[model samples]
Target: MTELDLATKAPESDAQEDSSVDSPTQSSPIMGDHEHCVTDRPAPAGQGPTGEIIKLNDIDVYISKPADYPHAPTRLLLFLTGGTGIKSVNNQIQADKYAAEGFLVLMPDMFGGETAPGGKEAYVADNSVSLLEQVKLKAVEIAKSFLIDMWLARVTEAKIMPILHKVIEAAHEEYSDAIKHGEGIYAVGYCVGGRYVLLLAKGTQEGGNDEESGMMKAGPFIKAGALAHAASVTPDDFKNLQAPLSLVCVENDALFTDEVRKVGEDLMTQDNVEHEVQVYPGVPHGFAVAGQYQESNIMDAQVTAYEQMLRWLKDH
Candidate 1:
């Protein structure tokens, strides 16, 4: 597997955490409601994003933070990439942008060792193999099909969440003061990763019932979320979501337009879930990547979508 030129070592301690909490808009008390837990605890680790790679769980992952992260207790903007491979530089640029906006950013390569186009397919195939392995360790009452689905969910979570938790925790360990006063952590996913935002909000998968073979206890990590250009998530899967979620889809994105609408509609109607769904006109599926469209109008549409998210975050 080819690795990007990310500096995988621990970050230099020069970037001091922001100590002030004097914003015009005070953060709402959301994170305080989360009951801190002591489950199977995973010790914290970090991977630097400056073209260095750090190996965690034997997989080389990259991370980065901004120079003037302001040491303020801050929120997080976690980006999950889609079908296309997650380019390290692209993620660093995005993370830098988020840090500039006062958010600690995290981007993980869930593609494992595969390349894009073919890389997404390879991820699913590898997941299938991992599912088989997990099935061998299942309880006798669990059917093979049920075990397979649970295992697949577990494989996905294992590939992504551990690293996510590690990244956030590492930031906290290095900048505890900033975190102690942080606003709240939020998540956003694009394409397949958009679906992942929902999955992460739903928490870890328990055994699925007879009708549904994969079940999850809602996780408290993400307080709010945004999903753009997403696909493959079903409405049944989202009934467990308790966070405020906003979904943005391009008019031309047939995947979200056709199939995902039902999921959005279902979410809108649910009680205790604050959500919004908007379709941008004339943009493509990956328009958020910035250079995907040459037309300024299309770019504007994507920017508008992003602005909506920022506004919602500030409001909610």
Candidate 2:
């Protein structure tokens, strides 16, 4: 794919409540210890969703249905994966956790179903290139390179939003029985995925050309949204949010810095959007989904953030 086509393929909350203080009702421990794995093992038949890879509008989507599918209705969660690319063990564990909690979770591969060459190891592989260089290279290939001027336009108009439209339509048709109770649609995104969450909430901005382009409007479908370790979000991005949002902020995230967090908060306040921004004291970005940090506090933060996301979805 060319850069533009690759770019096309690549690609919160309410309230003032402190989600950091929220604790999970049940313990959901992350898999493995420190090494992040790429291959995702299937969920045990009766424990969680029967995970499957299905085609949606020519795009491959990894779907995890609740074990008791169609027996009773449940909420639908579009679990967007982070910049590390989808098909990671970390994301699967988290999505299974959501499914275990009774959500029909749909995870789309934002990289047009492409897997990184060396899986999770490629990100941290021992090479002449430094780890930072590796990360930057991956980020560019996945998201950052396309997120320049008109970043929102490039993403919402070209990449994920169309895929989102197809997913929503397919869900209504395929899961009509399971979603009959009007449990409503909710979303959780990480890193670049988080950017997609915000775009859904805000819809098209003033000069976005969405009307002329006829892109799908997510504000009508999504009832609530949450995200962790979001990248490329700005104060101006919050202007047209139509639903409640929750933000799980990492205190030391280089991408979602304190300044950017403050701008988001300030903009939310000004816009009168129901939103929440909770700062986890010492963790770095991707702590929630990746579980890269093994410290007690960070692990606790992950559990708390997960609980908070569920709570927000239920509340809204």
For all candidates in order, the CA lDDT equals 0.47, 0.58
Tens-place lDDT digits, model 1, residues 1-316: 1110101111101001111111223322111101000011111124223433445334444444555555444665666655433453444444455565666555656556442221111111122234443334222213422432343344354455554555444544554544454455577776556766776666443322312212123365566787766644555546677678777765644345444465455654665577777767665455554233346786587668777776766565
Which stretches in model 2 have alpha-carbon errors above 4 Å? Answer: 1-50, 115-157, 178-180, 203-215, 290-292
lDDT tens digits, residue span 1-316, model 2: 0000001122111101111111232222121111111222222234433477787655677787778866767778888875444456567667888887888888877656543222222222234555555455454433422332233334443556666666767777777664565456788887667777777677453333343324444354576899876765665656677768888876655456666666666766777878877877776456667334336786688789889887887777
Backbone clashes counted, model 1: 18
* Candidate closest to the true structure, highest lDDT: 2
Which candidate number would show the highest TM-score if scored against the true structure? 2
lDDT of 2 at 265: 69
Q: Residue 195 in model 2: shift from native, Å?
A: 1.0
